[model samples]
Target: MRLFDYELSGNCYKVRFLLHALALPYERRAMNFHPGREHKAAWFIEHHHPRGQLPVLEDDGVSIPDAQAILVHLASRYDPAGQWYPDDPAIRARIAPWLAVADDLTGSAGAARLHDAFGYPLDIAACRRAARAVLRRLDDHLAEGASGGARWLAGTPVPTIADIACFPYVALAPEGGIALDAFPALRQWVGRFRRQPGFIGMAGIMAPQIGP
Candidate 1:
């Protein structure tokens, strides 16, 4: 398996986190998405057409783009226990909506991060507003989940792709000038995610603890 990766991308980091959590060994083809803009190269566009995005996963002869889609693929393929992408309809009901929220994070918090960090052209104020709204909603949901004895977004016993999907950009929200100070439940959820086994951290994300 091969993953076309960019170090600073939250979308890519989600895939990387899952690969490690699943203990799946794969090769990484690092793309310079920042100052280099290698993802726009003719070769990459030719082969990995349709969507020239970071965190492209290749397994056998199949190519999967979109970070959320890759998370579903990796979980369905490598997770023998069927925990990450559960087989239950009730669980799926909870999971799918949260995954969409992850995309919302990309547009809001994510766009702001890109504009600030990578110089992507966007309305910074609008992005920050979107981010704050999303965070407020997420924080409320997480708090409700806690009351219902669910720590993860999917209300599962353990972390699922839903949690993985939503985490990266949320954790990196400060980089986008979106403060998390008011979202205590969300903050706790982030800390819990960091402590999950097989966790991997990227730039702006704290490294997992190595001690017992």
Candidate 2:
């Protein structure tokens, strides 16, 4: 397997995190996503992702694009125990909406991050507002679930793709100038996620230090 990766991209980080969690070995084809704009180059666009997106996965002669779609594919294919993405219908039903929420986060918080970090032209204020709204919804959902002893986005005993889908940008919201301080439940959820076994972090999101 080969991953078309961008070192600082949260979307790319999601795929890398799952690969590490599954202990799946794959070659990292680090792309020049920043000043170089290699993802927008003709070869990449013609072959990997027509949308010129990073985090495209190539395995067994098949190419897969879109971070959320990649997460589902990796979980379904590599996770033998069915943990990251369970086979249960009810659980999957619960998981689906959060996947969409992840996309919402990308548009809002993600755009804000690109603007602040990479100097992309965008309405920073509007982006932050959208991010806050999504964060509030997520915090409320997590808070409600915590009231019933559920910690994961899908209310599963273990972290599912739902958690993986939503975790990164939420954890990195501060980098986009959207603070998590007001959302205590969301903050707690992020902390819990960071501590999960096999967890890895990318730029702006640190992997927790183990042991004393």
Candidate 3:
């Protein structure tokens, strides 16, 4: 198995975190997106994904793109007992909405911070506002016990890909100036994630609150 990923990307970190948690071993191929390494390369497009996105997973001859899709695939293949993803239809339904929120909050807010604060610097105030809104939503959700008293997002006894998917960006949000102190529940959740075995920090990133 091989994982093609960008070291600094939260999306890529999602896959890496899950794989490490599962004790799955694979060759890591780091891609350089800054110099258009992923975009300008024909081999990458043809063999991996034409979308030129980082965090492309190759298991044997099969290739999977999109962080959520990769999570599903990893859980299904590595954990068929549905520990990471429940088999019950109702549980699955409940789990699905959190994934959407994770994608929106973590994906959107993370990108906003990366582009505005680190990469290009466009409208820092707007980006910070958007990131704060997402954090507040997560704070409220966790306070409501959306995880059913479990420490993770999917209500599982252990952390699932759902938790893994959102951990990196949320943890590193402060580097983009999105404060975590306002979200106590979210902060506790991140603490639980860090204590888990085989956890790996996202490369070139810092959790201003958690301190990596």
For lDDT, the strongest prediction is: 2
As a whole number from 0 to 100, the lDDT of residue 152 in candidate 3 is 69
Q: What is the Cα-based lDDT of residue 35 in candidate 1?
A: 87
The C-alpha TM-scores of every prediction are 0.95, 0.98, 0.85
Stretches of model 2 off by over 4 angstroms after superposition: none
TM-score preference between candidates 2 and 3, better one: 2
Output the lDDT of residue 48, model 3: 80
TM-score of predicted structure 2 = 0.98
Cα lDDT listed for each candidate: 0.90, 0.94, 0.76
Cα distance off (Å), candidate 1, residue 76: 0.8
**Candidate 1, 33-131: lDDT as tens digits:** 878889888888777746577778889978888999999988988899998998898988889998999999999999999998878889999999999
* Residues 1-212 of candidate 2: C-alpha lDDT, one tens digit per residue: 99999989989999999999999899999999989999999999999999999889999989999999999999998898999999999999999999999999999999999999999999999999999999999999999999999999999999999998999999889999998989999999999999987678887898888887
Pairwise TM-score winner, candidates 1 and 3: 1
Q: Give the Å shift of residue 211 in candidate 2.
A: 5.0
Please give the TM-score that candidate 3 achieves against the real structure.
Answer: 0.85
Decreasing lDDT order of the candidates: 2, 1, 3
Weakest ten-residue segment in model 2 by summed lDDT: 196-205
